[model samples]
Target: MSSTLTVTGGAPLKGSVAVRGAKNFVTKAMVASLLGETTSRLRNVPDISDVAVVRGLLELHGVRVSEGAEDGELVLDPADVEVAAVADIDAHAGSSRIPVLFCGPLVHRLGEAFIPDLGGCRIGDRPINYHLDVLRQFGAVVDKRPSGIALSAPRRLRGTRISLPYPSVGTTEQVLLTAVRAEGVTELRNAAVEPEVLDLIAVLQKMGSIISVDTDRVIRIEGVDSLTGYEHRALPDRIEAASWGAAALATGGDVYVEGARQPDMMTFLNTFRKIGGAFDVDDSGIRFMHPGGPLRSIALETDVHPGFMTDWQQPLVVALTQAQGLSILHETVYENRLGFTDALVRMGATIQVYRECLGSTPCRFGAQDFRHSAVVSGPTRLQGADITVPDLRGGFSQLIAALAADGTSRVHGIDLIDRGYEHFAEKLAALGAQAVRDEEPARV
Candidate 1:
């Protein structure tokens, strides 16, 4: 597929598109297969690049990966798990940050593990200090090499108590993947309780790990000596579902997102209603639509689970551009998330970014210099312009903006959307979006 997409806008998108397993949960669950003694089966997996990266990394470590009888099913066998060559692992460097997650599971199967430098979306500060610190607490020796960081377990890894300064999803995943097989019990405070994290805990439980979650942000895991393989179906990608929902609202269309569960999108549903969007939920999926009336502006703040997700804000920002009056979006999760609004501004939306915390509650970024707050003044008519996709979610937001605008737009860097959103271009076509892959080469 070409990297550029030419989109003709100003039409409502109406139809249904199915969403599969979450990119966030599926990748980690694939990594968890390394801890099992037998083959594991995972279902509802999506055809995303991130999953392919993890599968390749797993194969490099000698895990046999194959398809199951059903579509979107993967059978992973780690019976021959071994150390991958440093050079081979180096080839995957900067492709994804998932490689760093291989540290604990690899150190368990092989006495030592080497991980190339990690790379992910250029969102904000995602330091690996928390991951390294938690690993060191589990008795793993960390050696920083030029090519990548090497970790070794001199003795059996022991469980330790940990309290994260914030409820970071990645750090919490690192702790869980490491603590599941460590000796004794591991208690983690201030952990992320996102649906994806809970789903991962469910996967671990199926694999014979004793895990408990409290009402508060506390998790305790009892280590077991051995684990057998598991048969599990991953949760649907709520981010992708919400992105489509936002797209529907932005274009004044109706979209039925199959596999979108109501339980996972309560907060977003409430916000969607507040912004004059309507949804009908059934067992199979949810249908998101813009009510006939004007879109209402809202005050939203991005937070962890049960709060407005940071990932949900970008595409919704496009919807906000057509809403009546002013809308305030204070991004408390990633500092640079609001930077995507600049593209919306270039497309003729009225948006202003600020460093001050615009939400009711002051957040960690309040004192920082990062422009994490955005105030959108809208009911402005959007005109299409040439756009360059930035990151995954941001790229999807730009696509929504282009579809909502008048005239034509040529969107570059569209491949980035494939990293998280599964077959999005095809889905857009299924939804009646007037977009086609550009046959000509993308501009340098």
Candidate 2:
């Protein structure tokens, strides 16, 4: 497949696109299947590269992965679980950071695990210290080496109390995956309460794990001796839905996103409406339309759940470029997330990056030197320019900008989008976007 796209702009994107399972949750759920003793069935799986990476890693460790009767269903059986060779595991290094997550499950199943150095999108600092600390607290031995970290359990892991410095979703997932099989009760403070995390908890519960969530950011899990497989359907990708919604707003188009649930998107929906984007919610999905006027500029901040998501900011920033006045965005989740706006500026959007906290409250990055905030002043015409895909969300944002720009744009590294977006080219086609793969003849 081609890694470049030729995009012709000046037209609004219109039509419908379907979103499958969330890349964030489905990949973690696939790892959870490693804990099951029998065959686990997963539905609504998207055909993203991250899922493929996890599947390859799972198969390397002796899990039998197969397709189910229905489309988007996966059958994973861990009956023949075994220790993967260090060299073999090392070969998968840099492909994904998911190997770090395999530590708890692999140790529980095979007594030891070798995880190569991790790699992921370069949005900001994503240290593995929290994951390592969580594993050590559970009585696992961690030996750091040049190639990767090696972990082993001398005896059955015993759960202990843990408190995260922040409500990190990845760290929270590590704790949950490890805690369920530990020997005692586990108490976690400052856990992420995102809907995806809650869904993961539901999946674990179906596997006979005792877990509880308090009103506060607290999670408790009782260790079980054994776990059976589970049948689960993953949740839709709310981030993708919001991205398309932003696309519609940026291009003055109307797009109906199928499979978008309103409950998981209330925060984003509220923000979208405040920006002069109109939406209608139904049982199946939501239809987003630009309400034929100058978009209102508003102050927004990215935070944990119940607040705007950091991932939703980049693409929406593209829409903000079309707003009538100045829009302030404070990114609290990842410090370098605002870096993608440079490309927007190159494409003729008036944007300025800053190092200070521009939001109502201070964040962890406020004490640091990262440029974590942005000011976008707009209603300026966007001109097409050459763009390169940065990270996942930023790359998608660039695509949205290209579609909304005037004239033609040559976008490189489009394959990066395949990491999270499933069948995006087809989705663009259905939405009447004038984009063609660089490998093919350009359409007039």
Candidate 3:
């Protein structure tokens, strides 16, 4: 059995919806609080399940988290940080990869850290090897067990040089969180400069750490002996904002997304414009709408920061289904990202996934047998169908498909959608879509 949403199609989702913190940064910022000797205040936090999950994990480890002076604010105090029971740690962190981030702060504060089995979206192969290897470079010894991995600093962790084979966002985060309080200066090459990472750096700076980022992708962090509290505002979630923008384009709707920063979405905005979508930018937010014309097609490829993000690719594919010609996308970031297109195909979208790279330059997965490229032919009228939600971004793409199709569409497994999107169903209702709830029996 699963929770389902029945959506009536052909209605534009026109209205304003608010977006809070970037989930990528807020969760890590919460983990950074474990390094502080005093209370840390994080504002503009979103009411997402990931935030709640991280808060629970922090509370489990004796970190105190409470509401701040305003709504969407969190006060995290690390005064009582301690090692938690392994079973409780396992239970609290069920399938979340966040526990891996606790290693650096815990090793500095308590000399040891235990990470339960890690989990995240089933997008691709996300291994903790990069994280573990980085920790080892910092003098932490790692021991593997059945339940999880245990890490201990035989001596105080010391800063070391690191060069990543790729600019993986997760590994870069692990390095930044751990390097801040290490014994000496640490240099990281080929680091990720995504906006979320930069915002996390801002949070750490407010907490009394010295870090530098160079245009050549080199980040140097000087370890400080001690740190205090911080009061900082989190960057708004650009992924969520882009998701709604793609939705407006797909349904021919007008959407005003409050708190969406234009600088963070320049790549996506440029691509949106090339596809014939119209947008207006203002100080408060950006508004995306259809200009009542036939949408043009585009050639797009997902890449690292400052390129089209893999997270943005999934939702935007929904809009491509309505374009006038062929839209080709080379998903260079994640090999299995195109898996979600299967559900879109079921919903009457003419999308084909390929193994070889379809762009000018072949990416890492080009030679691999993974389906990493897609060609979508559109101006095709979509119809309603029964679909199952795949992952977080994919789930939203499914929702867009359902909203754009004619007649009623039944979508199952929306609990996956709740992981990142906050009150999405309510937001959809507010946007004038005829979306309603329905319960279903078991699939097997």
User: Who wins the lDDT comparison?
Assistant: 2
Q: Give all candidate RMSDs, comma-separated.
A: 1.3, 2.6, 1.3
Q: Which ten residues in a row have the lowest lDDT in candidate 1?
A: 435-444
Error of 3 at 276 (Å): 0.2
Question: What shift in Å separates residue 355 of candidate 1 from its native position after superposition?
Answer: 0.6
Residue 339, model 1: Cα distance from true site in angstroms: 1.5
User: What TM-score quantifies how close candidate 1 is to the native fold?
Assistant: 0.98
Global local distance difference test of model 1: 0.92
- Give the count of colliding residue pairs in each prediction: 0, 0, 1
Indicate the worst ten consecutive residues by lDDT in candidate 2. Answer: 435-444
How well does candidate 2 match the true structure in TM-score terms? 0.98
Residue-level error in angstroms, candidate 1, position 221 = 0.9
The residue pairs found clashing in candidate 1 are none
* Rank ordering of all candidates by lDDT, starting from the highest: 2, 1, 3
- Model 1 lDDT tens row, 22-125: 99999999999999999999999999989999999999999999999999999999999998999988886566899878998988888888878788888898
